[model samples]
Target: MISSTPTTVTDRDFATEVLSANQPVLVYFWASWCGPCRLMSPILDKLAAEYGDHLKIVKMEVDPNPESVAVYQVEGVPAFRLFKAGEVVESSEGAISQQKLQSLIAPHLAAPN
Candidate 1:
């Protein structure tokens, strides 16, 4: 099991937790029935634990949170969106390698402030 304490985001909590976050936020848009989403869950959990302080990893169930999906234009499951200072800086869809995920997040990790 993944040991990271990933925040579960919903329609009610999206703006406060993600858009208004002080630190960078990694939002994973997923659905329970999506196979790839299930596969990436463990990896996301690991990332959350490893980068707990510098980043906030959140998981949103697309079916229940359509507003977020519409706002972010999430067309598929297992979508990953990185937000910095309340704006979406990067996004990815479908399955992705752990290395790619790390690479995409490297810049935010390197931000001085």
Candidate 2:
């Protein structure tokens, strides 16, 4: 379960990892009690591994990361924000399809050589 998965952005590392990082970052804002959030976990995990070389994927709990959630203006659970060069370039909210989610990040991915 992604709940058990670690290596995500904490309030402590958000600045360096997402805001100042050299690569694109995908932030999944979710809550433990949210059903849709739970459902989106595995899909994100798969995409994380698939896109690891070009993009960084991280999970942020809405319950514990109130600052980030509010800062991003997330109105719903299972929110995804794609950040590049320290700015949000794209965003989506809800339990969306894997294809739709992939489409969201595709443009941000580095082209294969």
- Highest-lDDT candidate: 1
Model 1 residue 105 CA deviation (Å) reads 0.7
Tens-place lDDT digits, model 2, residues 5-28: 324777777888789878888899
lDDT of each: 0.89, 0.84
lDDT of 2 at 25: 86
Residues 5-98 of candidate 1 have per-residue lDDT tens digits of 7899999989999999888899999999999988898888888888887888999999989988999999998999999999999999998988
lDDT for residue 1 in candidate 2, whole number 0-100: 25
Model 2 Cα displacement at 76 (Å)?
Answer: 1.1
Assess candidate 2 and give its lDDT.
0.84
